[model samples]
Target: MTGYTCTSCGEHHEELPFAYSAPAPAFWQDAPTDVLEPERCVISGEHYFLRGRLVLPVRDADQDFEWGVWVSVSKDNFFRAEELWDDPKRTDEPPYFGWLATELPGYEPGTLNLKTNLHTRPPGERPLIEVEPTGHPLAVEQRDGITLIRVQAVAELLRHP
Candidate 1:
């Protein structure tokens, strides 16, 4: 397997799984409500913007934490999400998807374990994830006014724990 030394973490990795593919957190269901109002960017009263730190699974031993993430939801998808936000019986809906809006300073795209089908927008257009219509225990949280998602907690949520 090919490997590269991470300049940010100084660790040798056989593969970079920076791209994360997991189920959207349930709390994302009510993005219109759950999303902090101040940080929210609403368009035409039907679309809203969701942006925050998306904690990656990559750990930095020196820093004792995982890498940083910043993702944003697309406008059209956000509108669709709003329509289904309060539907109690909308259980069969497909997962909400978002683009990979930004890139880490030193990482290359297509190397991370992110879902391939998802479209990545320009630097200003952040990546998107399907927001579950419910709350996932480990999905969303507030820290210093930033919405953060911990990779560890995400793993646990994926395992249906």
Candidate 2:
């Protein structure tokens, strides 16, 4: 009944908009040299620094989940994830950083859609679905480098933010 306008149907409803928020770097190829606080990797046995932000959902229904950016290092690898950045502003076990020892060339930041797939894993449920970035940053670092585009913490995203 107030301050709510639909983008497609032109319907008026009452709800807070800013539900989903993403890192949204100006361009995919641009990034800051230093984004994260210095930290040691538990997996790679190396010292690395990183920074990142979460890509929030565009809809209020999607805001059910907490959101933010994440960049951390462990013995295994240095990581920057957009989807998993939950708002400890509410829960525990923030999986902010975790991975096996490995090396990452780097990545470009952008928004992504979360989905579900029933083809793999524990069955009955399709976990996080990460569609490739149409506005990717400088191609997925050399073909061999492998760009691990993934989506996780979906249910959570639909539960908190």
Candidate 1 wrong stretches, greater than 4 Å: 1-40, 43-48, 51-74, 88-91, 109-161
Residue 80, model 2, lDDT: 28
Deviation (Å) of 41 in candidate 1 = 2.8
Q: How accurate is candidate 2 locally (lDDT)?
A: 0.26
- List, residue by residue over 1-161, the lDDT tens digit for candidate 2: 13444443465535433323233212222234323222211212243422222232322233322233223334222332222223232122223232111112123343221111111112222112222333343122211122111112232233332
lDDT tens digits by residue: candidate 1, 59-119: 3322222333323456766665446545643344454455333333323332122321222
Angstrom error of the Cα, residue 97, model 2: value is 11
Best of the candidates, TM-score: 1
- Summed backbone clashes in each candidate are 15, 31
Q: List the lowest-lDDT window of 10 residues for candidate 1.
A: 139-148
